[model samples]
Target: MAETGLIQSRYRLIELIGRGGMGEVWRALDESLGRQVAVKRLKPVGPQHDRTFTRVLRERFRREARVAASLQHRGVTVVHDFGEDEGVPYLVMELLDGQNLSQLLEENEQHPLPVEHVVDIAEQVADALGYTHRQGIVHRDLKPANIMRLTDGTVKICDFGIARLGHDIGMSSRLTTTGLAMGTPHYMSPEQISGKEVDHRSDLYSLGCVLYEIATGAPPFDQEDAWAVLVGHRDTPPEPLRTHRAELPGFFDRVVLDLLAKAPDERPADAGDLRRRIVLGRTGEQPALGPGPLARPATGLPPAPRAKALPAWTRSMTAGRPATGSTPPPAGRPDPAAGLTGQWTAATATAPRTGSSVPAGPPAPDLLATLEGRHGAGIDLGRLGRWAEAAEVHREVAAERLRLLGPDHPDTLATRYEVAYTLGRLGRWAEALEIYQDVARARAAVLGADHPDTFVARYEAGISLGRLGRDTEALEVYRSLVEDRTRTAGEADPETLRARHGLGVSLGRLGRWEEALAEAREVCALREHTLGPDHPDTVISRREVAAGLGWLGRWREALVAYRQVAEARTRTLGPGHPQTLAAREDEAHCLERLAQA
Candidate 1:
């Protein structure tokens, strides 16, 4: 490749950033987009090499580049473009302005990284593994040099679906007759050394080696000889992580050990589970993984969702409009002194109401339409984050519907449901609980107990119960709802699955972690099969599995699960979304657990 020239008339090579056995990585500019990019220039085969081998290499390069380009994720490096410039195949990727783990270790003078940073990186790598494995792609080579950590705290795995080229094509002659030394020997798994089939588990083992080195300042078997390192991976049991760093968290120590297991079966099930363990380990010490207390139950009957007090709706209205003692009423408006209150006289006879009727017929037909219009306006307000205004509008509509259509009317109950939702959005859990219960009861009576509308109301009631620390009540509600939903809509319905998810959450809250794990795993599998793994709801179910694993004292698996969720949420939803941040928070909590343990 030319030293300082344009490639394909689009990528202008600026300077060589790094070089490896297979290629040189250059800092370059994408003239088409006015952005920086990293250009990988594959080493050219010698003129004397067989045509068939060169053709095979070029084909493999194109196939791998295509696979890498197909990956659209935050945890994997983004490939911008790929092409051949004068027989030198090149790949253009998003220029990462951060150091790889190898660089970080060197910057730290070959010392171990901070415990928090080590766990964080472990979580990220595990998450990336989950995504890649799900796509039926194995990284084949995972080492410190292939993992990059950005300045914004984003960790990405590079050379996805293409690292094998470095070993298989670029350095084929370096391989011995026995077929050893395909990947960095320090991080190679036992199966890789034995020249047997490898899978995602092999990547886990390699990641273990990376985690061990980052946490303890050296790989598990840091032999100077490459062959000895390969042999050590196959035959030798690694020394305990604590042996090198006694101050390291015991939870982390156990996780690293599990990852280093020679047999793939002995490792965590997958990256999802690994992240979950990390989350649980870090947060296990807490009574609850998050805010919100579980309310104590009342005697006898199942604890009813409580309504503590009404929100201060009047406060906002009266804040700056205090009445003056001497203020007079506006012109033509009824004055208090002019009314019967001043004379204190009772009327001798009630005035006849001319327009009043004996029968209280259904409210004027136009009232329903007017109420619906107001309801829509309230929904629009809520969407704009004006929850207070929305709540007031919903409250007024609900009251009017009750007065005109009766408590059991679907429209009235629906309005009440909205009021509850708005109250919850305003953090008025008690008020929300009251309204949700009333709505649920009314809906159950008007529209059968198993009706979808009733189920929705009941679901909201359960959410309110959970918010007010009445998780036992919430659990009971969810359990009953699940059974009802299964009977009504079958086990595979999304609503049924939702109820099952709630039941799992409630179980977790009650500290029945083993039961919770079973429930969560069951729901996750079903969701994966029915909704697809990448669906937001399915991702949530996976997160629950991690939570259950963490609570069950499986820190390593929990860490993996949490990391997978965090990464998925960051991909499907933006990193700044509340759900994504929640996943990230769990990951951080797991790291903290490892640090303290």
Candidate 2:
């Protein structure tokens, strides 16, 4: 350790900053750039003659360098350089002058954060996390020690990609079983503890744990031993954030608790949604949250990177490969949303954004978003039912846009709604429901309940709920959505037409076949008027009308309507497409019912 003064004839090591299982951090200088840097000198491994340790450690170090160097975000600490300085592996990063969350907690034990402050920090971390998760990377080890609160009040995440590399290379042997293989028990996700194939949701759970601690200065699941903590994570729910800070908004508690859901299916669909809710809670007229000062963006910090602009592994901690079973199988190898794409959105310039003439020029710094909000525009090659690819792409773009542009900004929430619709088609109903709910809340928060986007997300949410088998619940949601859409989307708009169909399905599920038939006929008539009788959606809606008529015991009318749908679909989409085949099947069934009648 004595010989670790400086390296590269630059980055002069001034003093030891901190130490962890892997190594010690040193305040250093970048002689080339005349900037301050933090260098982590990893603890060395076994005997040089031990080829096994040496070979493994070297590979791990290289992978870490690649991962850290690749990560460039305002919330993430920047890795300037990494090299073997005289046989000791060293990684140089931006020197953030700040105290860690651990230190802050130690100073103020059990003292709850101001609601606004807790939300601000959570929003920033969620944004960075969303980006990292999308890159297919999970922190695997998120805790207070890894998060630093900069002098200017900004939170900077550190040692992101290094935990895996550092643990594998040599740190595990030194720290014992309590260190490398398992994470800080208080923050470990259940899947991570069980060593199951984890996903981005695992990271969200871990982050929720972190937020739990920050909100109340106590770990969500506290037990005497690491094993107990693991069990608590698997079984227990954290005390609601409001319990600790009763002044906290009820919505904030719901958001945090949702993140801590035992199953990922129950959590908010992604980190982007988390951020949106935070924004609304903090800034809304009747803020679901409290009075926290809005964050200033021009502070000294690097700009966020454009989301979906990085290499795959940048967010691939959970990706494991180009495929995740979370969504249906995609079409090709390079999926845009393959990684931790929807973890957090990149922060746009968040300065007082009320005036119609928005601020121009380069965006302000110190914002916590990872994506720069540049959405990709390109045509994908056709693939056989590659619904996953389209769904993922729309989800990624929509999440980023919402975070970058806000709910009513036209692009962000709008794009997200498209992704939800795609998820329904791709069979990811649970996730789609979550996404649609988020969009709905954001729309209701920003634009009021009657806004078009509000109805859009609510309508989609009702559709997802219907597919998920909570039909009675779906009926209520769809009924409200149908009314809302009729008023906002108008009877002829495609979305309104779609919701009308949802209403009929919900009614059938509730055994109100007469009402179902009437609504279906109305939607079909409206669609036919607006889209021409032969249009695909119109023909599909018409088929639904026939199905409703059959349910209502009007078999002869059902057969007639079904025949028209089958012919129209067979003409436009040929005989093999799913919709076309479905229409034909419906027509045949209706004919049989008619003969019986």
RMSD of every prediction: 22.2, 24.7
Query: Ten consecutive residues with minimal summed lDDT in candidate 1?
Result: 313-322
lDDT of 1 by residue, 1-597 (tens): 468899988899998998754467999999999999999876766653334334444654676687688777789998888888998999998999899999999999999999989988888888888887777667767889889999998999986533442223321111111122235678877666544446777788899999999999999989774434664675456899999999887878878887887656567767777777777777653223232112222332222112111111001101111111223433432232332222111210122124422125434447667888998898887766566677789889988866665555556667788888877655567888898788778656545565576677787788778667688999999899889888877898777887887787677667787888898899889988998877866776786677667666676687788777767867887764544544554554454355446
lDDT of 2 by residue, 325-439 (tens): 1222223212223222321112223332565232332223323133323233211300222344555566666655444444444346556766665555444568779988987
Cand. 1 TM to true fold: 0.46
Name the regions of candidate 1 deviating beyond 4 angstroms: 161-181, 285-597
Give the best candidate by lDDT: 1
Candidate 2 weakest ten by summed lDDT: 305-314
| Candidate 1 lDDT score at position 282 | 75
